[model samples]
Target: MARVIALVIVLPVRLVWDALGYCLKQLWRWVLAPIGRALGWLIHHLIVIPLRFLWEWVFVPVGRALWWVIDLLVVTPLKWLWGWVLFPVLKALWWVVDLLVVTPLGWLWRYVLAPVGRAVGAALAWAWDVAGRISRAVGRALGWVLWNLIGRPLAWTYRVILTPVGHWLRTWVWAPVASVARAVRAAAREVRVALFGGPR
Candidate 1:
């Protein structure tokens, strides 16, 4: 008797689900049928009719006429201008520029600058020889005094104090600075100097 009652309850639920599924299927078919017919009609009328008309009435004769006009007006004129006018004009200009600038520049660089450069180099060589002798004498005198008086002690002090300070200054204190910030700082300094009259 409990099995019979359970089967009765499940039968009604199954029937209700089947009815809902049928209604949804019928509604979808009804909605899509009209849209499919309309699309078929549009494909027949809009696409087929215009394509046939273009092929039969417009395309062939227009294409031939365009080809002929382009051959006459565009292609012929371009060929004539390139062959007769443009090439010769560009070549002539190139030749003129070669004569005026390039040839003279080559001669000047080769002959004129070569001799003048040799003369100036000889004078500089002589000056450097004289300066080298004088600098050697001065350096010897300074070296004698430093070795006798200040060399060892001063070197020791610098090694103790300045090496670490120089490293710290380079790595942490002084660095690559932005140009805009530098400019702003300089402007501020100038304004302060003008306002305060620069350290009395």
Candidate 2:
């Protein structure tokens, strides 16, 4: 009876557990693992390997060839032309400019312009000196004429007429007026003292 009960309980439990474990194993093998492997293969072959090949062979070589062509066709020719043609032409132009323009200007400045400037400056200085002498002579003549005509007459008049008149007025008229003012002030002081009975 005990063996029959144990078999009835344990057998069903073991069977259920085994069924679940087998299902899990089958699901992993058929679904998850295959998906992971497919993804890895796709990435390696399509994206990574192709990019590596393109970089190593196609892109690098093409870039190098393009640079080589640019140097051969453009840079080398431009450098050669500049060295052979443009450099010589520019040097010749500089020589011509120095000969035609610069040398002539230097000669003109040395021979023609310098002498003319010196002559002009000397003439101006001479004229200025003559003008200054003439001006001084004129000023002296005017001063002498003014002294004789106006200043001397005014001085004579002041000495002869004004001095005596001013002295006479000061002696007669001013002295009398000052004496009368002093007398009037003395009388006012006496009247104030008698009325107010104090100095003020």
Candidate 3:
């Protein structure tokens, strides 16, 4: 019974809330429609119409007239004047370019190359001298070490380690292979002489 009562109360409240929402929406549209119409009228009559007129009547013809006058008065005269007055000016400019840009660049090359070449030459000479000194020192040190400390011991070590291996290979592997190769060669020569009527 309590649940049924609660449901009945909630249903009427929902109905009232929906009716209020619909009424508020209708009222808002009714109020804003006139304001929107007025704003449209204001923009069309005041802003857009004047802007269109200014663009069509003032901006286009004035810009065209200005361009025509500039072409006739300024650009055409300057073009002609360029031939008359600009020749000497261009010659002067060329001379200036030769003096300022080319000559200075030539001088810069001489100035820079001489000093830089000299410095590089000096540096290379110094480097070569230092390298020679270092090489001599290292060579002397290595020679002394080999003569005094390592040469005899290294020779003894080589003899002890390698002599037996060398002897064994010379006796076993080298001797047998050499003998077999010689025998094969002799038989090949005999067969060739028998077939080809004596050796060449």
Candidate 4:
């Protein structure tokens, strides 16, 4: 009973809701969709197409003509002026400089400076060789003086005086002292053995 009552109650409401939804779908598909498409077509034809045509045909040609005029009037003349006038003037100035200044300087370098430089270099080399010889002779003389004054005398003293004194100390003083110490040690050992009654 409860199920039958619920079915009866819900059936009309469901049918009304589905009818409203179907009506809304049909309205969107027929009316709103066509209106939107018409508006899109109007915008494309009126605004977009005219702008594209103007950009392609009018504006591009005008810009290209302006650039060509600027190139012909300004840039070409400047390039010709630099190539024909300024370049030759600068080249002639360079030639004058080469004739007046560079040739004279070269002559001075070859004639005067070359011989002077060679003579100076030869003199310096000769002086350096003399200085080396003098330094070597002085070093040899110094070495000879040091050997005679200090080294030979010290060697003689070590060989003659020190060696004999060391030998005498070792033989006379060390040997006698060692002998006396041995005798005292032996006597002490004998006395200790007799007093303690131990076998030696």
Q: How far is candidate 4 from the true structure (C-alpha RMSD, Å)?
A: 11.5
lDDT of 1 at 20: 94
Error of 4 at 126 (Å): 1.7
lDDT of 1: 0.91
RMSD of each: 21.4, 17.3, 22.6, 11.5
> Which tens-of-lDDT digit does each residue in 1-200 have in candidate 1?
99999999999999999999998888778977778889999998999999999987899889989999999999999999999999999999999999999999999989999889999999999999999999999999999989878987788779988998998887766653455579889999999999887875
Q: Which stretches of candidate 1 lie over 4 Å from their true place?
A: 1-17, 28-31, 59-64, 118-133, 145-200
- Tens digit of lDDT per residue, candidate 2, span 1-200? 99999999999999999999999999999998999999999999999999999999999999999999999999999999999999999999999999999999999999999999999999999999999999999999999999999999999999999999999999999999999999999999899888988654
> What overall lDDT goes with each candidate model?
0.91, 0.97, 0.93, 0.97
Q: TM-score of the candidate numbered 1?
A: 0.52
Taking all chains together, each candidate's TM-score versus the true structure is 0.52, 0.58, 0.44, 0.58
lDDT of 3 by residue, 31-126 (tens): 777788999999999999999999999999999999999999999999899888998899999999999999998998899988899999999999
How would you encode candidate 4's per-residue C-alpha lDDT over 40-122 as one tens digit per residue?
99999999999999999999999999999999999999999989999999999999999999999999999999999999999
In model 2, which runs have C-alpha deviations exceeding 4 angstroms?
1-82, 197-200
